[model samples]
Target: MAEWLIEEGIGESRAILVEDGAIVEAAIELPGALRPGAVLAARLAAILIPGRRGIARFEDGSEALVEPLRGTLAEGAAIRAEIVREPIPEPGRPKPAKCIVTEAPLRPAPTLRERIGKSSIHPPVGPDRFEEAGWSELLEEAASGEIAFPGGALRMSLTPAMTLFDVDGALPPAELAIAGARACARAIRRFSIGGSIGIDLPTVPSKAARQAAAEAIDALLPQPFERTAVNGFGFLQIVRRRERASIPELVQWDQAGAAARALLRRAERAPGAGPRTISAAPPVISVLGRNPEWLEELGRRIGAQVRLRPDPALAIAAGDVQSAHS
Candidate 1:
């Protein structure tokens, strides 16, 4: 049995390296603010980055390969000490991933609905500093085919003239753009998204193509939508009204990693506890870029307990949620 650490609401997890299938011998080292998961990640999973990797001691005492944890893993509650399998070695070193092992107990934070539940909203007007730091495991889940949430299902299409979203619910469509060349006068309302969002739509060849898609999106826009732009890389440009302390885009995260010195002590500790439970969630890990299933497997290996929640839906800000009510 091992310890598994999972992030709240997001689709990522992490594991710790255990000696002889035991975690007490694991040790972790991290750099930065001491979040709930800092110490364990450093010691147990030896999570250097996020991806599907494994570290197990062989019967002959040889170190095994790494496969990071990935995907949206949720359960009614944490399961401790259930026998699980170890993965085979990768043909080669694939790109690494992160395992963001974080979870703020529900007692302190806002309810999942309060955090993201929105019924409808207007589109955003302009761009704001939209940055968030997430573990590579999160990205992997988004990029991979085994993703529990579909990309199209999670993202919205925003035009400066209109905000476009399709919820399989009662609300109608919405729009904000007006034929181009104008900034929105006020902030567009936050649509009812579950949480972090990603988008994919038709490709636009020229400015005309941009507006054409906008027009089509606009025609369906009966309620109120926001604005969006596309980047040179063909990535959709989403114009979401910024949130307070959002997930931190363009962010960087990694497991604090283990000091070679720490290895000497790992042998003396308990199973899954990572040689030491410096903190409740000792092992701290993070993921960046794109990956899928990097977090789930990590949780299974180390046996960290996690309480999964639905992804954050689009939360209407105080003003918008209020205005939306009005």
Candidate 2:
């Protein structure tokens, strides 16, 4: 039976669904994000489209794009809104968080544990259950946007419009299409990716081959998603409800922060226990420095002092944790 294994790590929380000793789905939740389902008290900042859409400024000064505004709601008028989607980070400008006017009481966003519920298993800190289940490998895939499967590979790219996957390999066209479609479907689920998605499979002239490719996606991906039929160009489009940021979006948005959090996770499990030293790039060190509380919690959990060493030569993702005496 599939089970969710959760790790409440420093600065972030991670969960993976494991079946047959392999991960099928993964999710990571970072702190302080305005997650979906959070109802907030806000004032109408501006009406971008009269009686339809506008920007709402929350109490914290954070703003979200709100829609379906009532005709009577004027600028600076107080109203309640429920977040529908977290802010999407794009190249130049980030798309603001999306919300709809609501009468729901203002409430804090749900934490990962709260969202996942009590049924998920939370493993003790000593053993790295996440690592054993290929957590690092999954992160690499999210960072690089490359996923390999049996016959082919999918190169994922995040764009302002949609997330796209381009399939490539040495397999025959028909076989590659089927395999790629399946792999793309799995990648979408594994990464908790949603919103609009496009997949480019190897072009197979035969209609039967195209049908097989489409069916492969149907077999792997669950419901609550709509997908277009594979066109002659072997392109398929999928649309899923997007709530929070996907793993790729989170990892890529703040590379240094991601590295720092990942290093802290390793530091928590680092053996020997005299003192833990994290040697990382300057930006990663800066991220850790900003979150002194996270470091303090790590020290408390491990019963040892934690230190940071910034090495300019080290890559952000290549940070290492070591015992002082080792």
Candidate 3:
């Protein structure tokens, strides 16, 4: 049966839609992020585009990019704003959360459980259901931006503008283009990627081949998305409603944090645990140490003492959990 297997992990909540014993889609929600639909009371911090757009400073000192502002309102004027999109992390200048002026009641961001309401919620526990559903492979793809299909591979690159996928393999141009397009579409859905996307397929001279490649994307990708036809240059663009960071964005933004959270999840499921020792790189250990509450909760859940050990030689993603007896 198809179901969303949710795992409320230490620092993040995750869900995977499993169908026929395979993951079709996945999502991760980090705590404290300003999810869409959250309303905040704030002051106009700065006027970016005179009367049309400005910055809103919340009471907590954080700021969001607010738009459709009243031209009469100057800086320092209090206003209620509703978040339309979460902050997007980029190379140097990250995009701030986006909001619109509103009179809606101020409400905290919805929790993952609340956001995914009434869905077939299967709280996976005791066993690592996510790992069983190729979770590690998904994370690897998100981190490395390399996905392998049968006859070709997709190299995804994240840019300030859009996510680009370059398809390459040892196949005929027409055949590879069709297969790569399908693979790219599946990966987009699997990673919950949104926003602007560009796919570069093999250059096929035949217009019919280009149309077939575009059709492959349409066959797999769901609605609420717009895509341009495959052009003569074998380039296609897709636009999806982006509200929050995708899995690749989250992993690439802070690899150490991603590793830390993943380690915590693994430690929670370690076998025959008494005093569990988590060994990893210093940065990853630092992330875990900063969150003592997460460690305490891990201990409480596993009925053991959680310990952190930093190894300079260890890679961030090479964290290992060992039982006291081991």
Candidate 4:
């Protein structure tokens, strides 16, 4: 699996999808390489997805798709992406239009926004208990209206060291270990990985050791699946892939934006001291927008009750781009 780092951070942000590489038609940015400091966007409360059927329309209509996602964010964090495009579209289809996308931070967690899934496992699965084996496979499902991918099985994993996945060039891998890794991380994204991952796997691994190492990469990168450095013993430390890019791409960005506003606006109206329950509870709510009043307006626009909080201001910021499952 692979992890990205956003160089700048996003503040009061939202994603803008560009289409045919122009504003007339919008498209959302997908992730490729991310810096360490700007990885927080994936951890934010909501992500907007632009579905296959509505890519151009979503932007042309500016009708954001309201798909719930699993992430949390502050304001002014810039979301950047490094995508590996498929050289060709379907056999009979016209070539895809070149596209450019960007994300702008929103106000502090929007008071009213769509509810993504909640944190399934909190405090995380520790490193010492790696061998206990009581962990259930992460099954994808809906915490609310939004759905989680790779939910059929294989939950996300986490490791202490940063994982550096060497994607041969800038393209998606098609094999199982690589495919599964890309698929998993693109679906569930709960844990953080460290260290540069070097992929030396051949098109086929003749030895068991080589095969296991590949498996370990897939297993150890997602949430709940926690571990440290893969020991040199050659035994792979396989785990679930990091879940991301599902709801983001499944729905239209406009729809997702509206839902996010609705969710946050409700939260902004909340009379309680802490956050409210949305299908499940999120650690924090993201009120991403450029203006505090706009965020407040968003909350007020919603009938629900939650107090809105302001985010610290910053001159330069960046957000994280999500990896896609498809």
Candidate 5:
């Protein structure tokens, strides 16, 4: 049976689905996750290029796009809207969550926890299994560029438009392609990778060989996906629904943001109510310095002052929390 391991961390919630002793699905819910099916009372913010894209401002100062809704919306006019899609995190930008004008607006926005409870997946119960399976190590591996399979390896690259995978190893062309396809599918599902994906396999000479490779891919990837057959150039494209940003996108491009978040999470779990100091790389410290709300929350939660120290030589992802002596 597949088991759910949900951890409510400081600034985020993480879920891992373990099946057959392996993590198959992993999801991270950040603070900004806006659940689908949520209705809100919003005001029209702008009508840029009217009839195509208009922006709405929610009560909490969050904004969503009102597009192709069939009528002119005067700027700053009040409107009721429902979120058809959840807000996805983009690097250093607001989530472009899609909303449609609704006659009935939900009073309170549904939170991530509430949505997870209502998901097809059952509510989490019993002891945690995340640390038992060394999930942190797995997370590190997923963020890395190169991932290894049995005989070959896959190099994953994240592009602005799509994610790319290059398959290369010592195995034969057909065998290597099959193995790579299976591995790629597994990686895609495990990391919750979405959007356009292109896999470059070793050039196969015959049509039958390419067909076989495509079959292997089809057999592995789950439903609700569209894929193109392997072309003569040994390239295949697969498109998956992009509900939210991929794990790599959340971690790789924003190391400083991750570091700042890590500092806050660590502080939340720190021992005692004493003042604490966080030491991290200069960039990480700068991120925290710029955002005093994080520290203010930490102070409110622990009832103590928090200090940040910059270590010029520390790695961007590394951080240490220490208690003040006095």
Candidate 6:
């Protein structure tokens, strides 16, 4: 049976799904997730498709496209809306979100993680109940892009449109394809990589061989995924439903933001704290500097003042949370 272990920290939350003592799927919610069912006030930013589609800006610097059920809307108009889809960050483009205009704030819907936690089938476990489950090591591998399996390896790369997994090793093409397919499925679920995915396997000349490879993948990958058959060039395409950005994207496009949230999580978890301070690179500090609410909440949670110090010499994404007196 699969069990969910949820850890709710200041500014963020993490839910890990463990089955047979191994993590299979993980979901993380960051600050300003803009998750579906969240009601927020938004100002119409622009008329993209004239009346059909328009962009709206939220107070938290997030933007979503608004589609009213009825009535005319114009630029700079204030509207209460419910998030339909969370914003997705695009390379060199604005983060895009979608919403439906509402006259009043509707009751928020349950998030995916929340629903999973409350499921009678997989109830959530206590916080830190599975700290020894090697989650850090697994996440480290997922972020690194290189995953090794029994007979082959997967080189995962993220692109603006889709994620690519290239299989490589000295094993026989058929054997390597089978092992690589299973590994790719595991990586996709473990890292929570969503949206478009492409897997490049070793070329198998025979039609039967290729079919076997595809079957191997089908057996391992779960439902709700649309995939194409392996082509002559050994390229397979799979599309998964995406609501939120994957772990790699969060770490890639928003290193400073991720580090700052991580710092706050660390500071809030510190024990026997008189006062705790986070020291990070200037960019990280600057990112956190924009939000004082997190610090204020930390003080209330820990019953101590919290501070952030910027160090020019520190590397990006490198930060320390320590006693203020240290």
Best by lDDT: 3
Candidate 2 ranges with C-alpha deviation above 4 Å: none
Q: Give lDDT tens digits, candidate 4, residues 122-173.
A: 1111331111211111111111222232312222222122222222322222
| Reference-based lDDT, each prediction | 0.25, 0.89, 0.89, 0.27, 0.77, 0.76
Instruction: Give the better candidate number (1 or 5) by lDDT.
Output: 5
lDDT, candidate 5, 109-154, per-residue tens? 5555565563333222333356466566666755686888998999
What's each prediction's TM-score?
A: 0.22, 0.96, 0.96, 0.23, 0.81, 0.82
Higher-ranked by TM-score: 3 or 5: 3
TM-score of candidate 1 to 2 decimals:
0.22
Worst 10 residues of 1 by lDDT: 317-326
Q: Candidate order by TM-score, highest to lowest?
A: 2, 3, 6, 5, 4, 1
TM-score of 4: 0.23
Worst 10 residues of 2 by lDDT: 118-127
RMSD of each: 22.4, 1.4, 1.5, 20.0, 4.0, 4.0
The sequence of per-residue lDDT tens digits that candidate 1 reaches over residues 58-150 is: 222333223333323232212111112112112233222222323433222232223333311211122210111222333232222122221
Candidate 2 on 171-257: residue-level lDDT in tens? 999999999999998899989999999999988899999999999999999999999999999999999998878899878877898
Query: Candidate 6, which segments miss by more than 4 Å at Cα?
Result: 39-46, 50-52, 57-62, 66-82, 100-105, 109-113, 119-130, 271-273, 324-326
TM-score computed on alpha carbons, candidate 2: 0.96
